[model samples]
Target: MIANLLTIAGTDPTGGAGIQADLKTFSALGTYGMSVVTGLVAQNTRGVREIHPVPAAFVAAQLDAVFDDVRVDAVKIGMLGTPDVTRAVAGVLAARRPPYVVLDPVMVAKSGDRLLAADAVRELREVLLPLVDLVTPNLPEAADLLGVPEAVDEDGMREQLADLVRLGPAVLLKGGHLTGPECPDLLAMDATGEPVRLTAPRIPTRNTHGTGCTLSSAIAALRPQRSGWPDAVADAKRYLSGALAAADRLNVGSGHGPVHHFSDWW
Candidate 1:
């Protein structure tokens, strides 16, 4: 078995997102996968219907259980829905201090459903974001964290990237949801002091569920095994684009569907 990469996120019963996507991503990229679910989400590819958070103590215990035994090379975090939940995740991270932490500030789902509590958004900024090594926020999420409303355009996207970088960790401003046909992603950090913009042709389809979780987890898993962050992202971008293209042939849920996790595995 390959060594493990831990995913700390919510559970999606539909197997289209959250910890499900993260695990699939880790497995697809040749790693052992494990999960510590902070919340149980009643969700499909369409949207999140309800969320029931796991008890804070149990969340702690789950984290402790995994970190105690497995040598987790990296971690990918998503959907800590409450301030208390975020705090519990923080406590676990503090205790384990995994080598690489990739935070996918998962505020909204693919089908326009909000995944984060407003109070927890603030807590993520104050408590969680600082401790992470990398923070991947989509355009709208970057806008929300930076206190701006109109980030649907390119100029607005770049401004929000800078604003998010000030919050502590390196910020990866995902521009895939933007209007342009070409998806341009900005990797902004203090060390670079300039946005490493990666532009790719946007794939046109509605079946893109759990993409953020998968992408961030892929980045988390690949970044450690590979040398360069930019290269890792570039390679993962190609991988995900292929996954999305492959998504068109598969059928899952009724709404925005899932990418094919086992496209190359078989």
Candidate 2:
């Protein structure tokens, strides 16, 4: 059966990130996509100007509406603006227990705007991390979650990965933030004997607005079709790279633009 993937995230009217990006990714990978909006963001590729959060109760209602009708094969959770919203999402996931859950710890936007609130970090780490199959965090987000300095090198990345795994989810520690020609992502889980390392040549591009959202959502879309996380992650990485490599082909906004979701087709 084709996978039904749900993205619980905020909105990006520019179609570069959040719910729009997630749905596009799901479709690009040949999966059915659904969404629950957590915040209404008024912005574009340039920057986020204003954010209007959805109430916690309504967030729960939206989740229920999806779970009640569809058989969700996997879920990709992005920006939850506040702690209460985080708890609401966690509560529903705890009750529903979807087969696969991927958390992209979306703390800051590519434009450097903060998407998640400061206090919400605690709730996400304490309540949400444990329930997910995998938690994908960039260097800064990993540091924020662990309450430590951002990893500057491979050693720091490994050190933080160890600390994060104890928090109760397999971690896909992205090394894109590190200043290097090549970007490496580490996937470490308790059951998986050794951590798998996947590296790609860093594609130089200013159009990387929703790279995180795209990668995580792509993993969720492919997980049900693939046998395991490693394969899904590897394939997702390839997709993101292609999207990044082809990003310049599209004319979007002025600032950091979005990667092409349909890079392979159009």
Candidate 3:
């Protein structure tokens, strides 16, 4: 059986994030993964050194090729490096309208290095935000995406996440980076919906490279084989928390390092 999932994101040479991490997550979770590369990134777990975005035409073409041939049950979008790439991605998502779409709003790396330009943030919100089913933004990324100054715990993270909900799609405000030993990954839906908070003990490790991409992709892989949004988020949280716990034992880079996706994966 071909359990196909598509990852439309940038390329990560370190195999820690972007398309590389998404594909690894899909495979680990028993989905045969296909990818549409939007940008070419040069980096390790430490940080992104360079980014060369694929041409807009080529980016759209890649998606066209995949859609024309593959049976994609789910799709994950990440790291569209430029406004052009973002527009291209939005177009593909609108056209294909896959059953499950997970959007990881990858603006900056966990190391605080810039993966996207300041101006491209507007393009993402205007073009891609409404096209996907769900958007997973880490604390900082969520803040940036929502025009909020910062995602400070002292400044009320829940309200910030609630504001992010107005951006159209369901928002999962990942609280892993919140200042605490225990982290809660929050799911804030549209208005009138009860927010679901899935909390997990923060893993004691520094190898958290590519966590957002991995989490969203894992959820995409599970959705076709599982239930709906909240269920998918729960499954993704379980898989990622396990990956984080095994992260320090992984040996992929001299920097933050990659997750050990093969162990205890969904």
lDDT of each: 0.85, 0.95, 0.85
- TM-scores of the candidates are 0.96, 0.98, 0.95
Off by over 4 Å in 1: none
lDDT tens readout by residue for model 1, 67-179: 88889888899988888889989878877788889999988888778889887888899898888988998877887787678577778878788778888888788888777
Best by TM-score: 2
lDDT of 3 by residue, 1-266 (tens): 65799998888887888888998899888889999988888888778788888999999999999899888898898888888888888888888889888889888887788887888999998788887888888888887887767666724677887777887889888887777888887787685587888888888888888888999999889889886888888988899888988887778888888887877633
Model 3: lDDT of residue 241? 85
The predicted structure with the larger lDDT, 1 or 2, is: 2
Error of 1 at 134 (Å): 0.6
What tens digits encode model 2's per-residue C-alpha lDDT throughout 101-184?
A: 999999999888999999999999999998999999999999999999999999889888888998998899999998889999
- Residue pairs clashing in model 3 are none
Candidate 2 global TM-score: 0.98
Say which candidate scores most in lDDT: 2
lDDT of 3 at 138: 84
- Higher-lDDT candidate of 2 and 3: 2
